[model samples]
Target chain A: MKARVTVTLKNGVLDPQGKAIEGALGALGFDGIGSVRQGKVIDIELGETDKAAAEAKLSDMCEKLLANTVIENYHIDIL
Target chain B: MKARVTVTLKNGVLDPQGKAIEGALGALGFDGIGSVRQGKVIDIELGETDKAAAEAKLSDMCEKLLANTVIENYHIDIL
Candidate 1:
């Protein structure tokens, strides 16, 4: 089994790095680009697990480590 | 129109930040988490633009700014 996990900053979190990327994009002639934000991606391969267990585990992973619940949210796609 | 842009370090790129994150996750008791990689996500809202034009613009943004072409690969999804 495989899971693609994404972690991102919640709305209103100041993102300096994202801003820098946007500035760089505009400078690079990528007009029409309004804003830029950054996040994290984690790919995990879990062997032969039940869907419910996987979901629970994935959420636990996010709450415990993958995301900073205070400022970030996470989603996982299991395959 | 909306697009989500993501930028990530190429494989073999030393990711100290990711390592720190993984360490923090472990400390927080997230076991079974093997590795962690960090990346960037950029969301843009373009008012009534064709997909082709957006693609071109996005590629330019990535090549020149959003991603370091030499080290990162980016993907954009139109919504």
Candidate 2:
């Protein structure tokens, strides 16, 4: 089974990297850009075949290592 | 309009960051893990409302800045 985990900064958190990208895009002549926020996507291949079991394991992985719960939010998708 | 761009390393390309994450997960006691790849997801808010135009603009942005075509692939989603 394949699973994907997306880790994003929570609302109200400052994202300097996103700001840098936004500035760079403007400099590159892209216009009408409102905001830019960056996040992480992790694709994992698991030996587990059960959909529910894979999702549960992915969630545990997110809580334990993939994300910092205090400032970032994580979503798991079983693919 | 909201757009999302996901940039990922091409197959056969070496990803040290991904290897590091895989190792970390193994150390953290995650079992039955296979290959792990990491990528970037950028969420952008565009002033434009037309979906087709927004997608075209995003494709251009990906070509010019978000992705390295030689070793990375980018997928754009309009939401």
Candidate 3:
């Protein structure tokens, strides 16, 4: 089974990297581009075939190290 | 309008960051986790409300600055 974890900054949290990318986009002539928010995606393949077990493990992984629970929120998708 | 861009390393390309994360997951006790790949997701808000225009601009943005076309592949999604 495969699981994908998406980690993104919480609403209202400041993202300097996103700001920098916004500026860079403007400089590169991408007009009308508004705010940009950056995040991370982790794709994992699991030896375990059970869908439920894989999602639970992926969630645990996110809680432990994949995401900063205080400022970042993560969603797990099983595929 | 909102657009999302996902950037990932091409197959066969070495990803030290992903490797490090994989090792760290093992060290942290995430068992049964197989290969892991890391990527970036950029969420952008466009002042233009036209879905077609926004997606086109995002594609251009990815080509110009958001992705390294040589070693990375990027996908753009309009939401």
Q: What is the lDDT of candidate 3?
A: 0.89
lDDT of 2 by residue, A1-79 (tens): 9988999999989999899989999999999998899999999999998999999889989999999999999999888
Candidate 1, residues A1-79, lDDT tens digits: the string is 6677788888999988778777776676556666667777876655436877777888887887678899998888885
Best-first order by DockQ:
2, 3, 1
Q: Please give the lDDT score for candidate 1.
A: 0.75
- Lowest-sum lDDT 10-residue window in model 1 chain B: B29-38
Off by over 4 Å in 1: B20-29
Q: For model 3, how does the per-residue alpha-carbon lDDT over B1-79 read when each residue is reduced to its tens digit?
A: 8888999999988988888889999999877778888999999999988778777788888898999999999998888
For model 2, the stretches where C-alpha displacement exceeds 4 angstroms are none
What TM-score would candidate 1 get against the native?
0.79
How high is the TM-score of chain A in model 2? 0.97
* CAPRI-style quality class for the chain A–B interface of candidate 2: high
Candidate 2, B17-43: lDDT as tens digits: 889889999999998999999999999
Give lDDT tens digits, candidate 3, residues A1-79. Answer: 8888989999999999999999999888778878899999888888888888788888888898999999999999988
Output the better candidate (2/3) by TM-score: 2
- Better candidate number, 1 or 2, judged by lDDT: 2
State TM-scores per candidate. 0.79, 0.98, 0.96
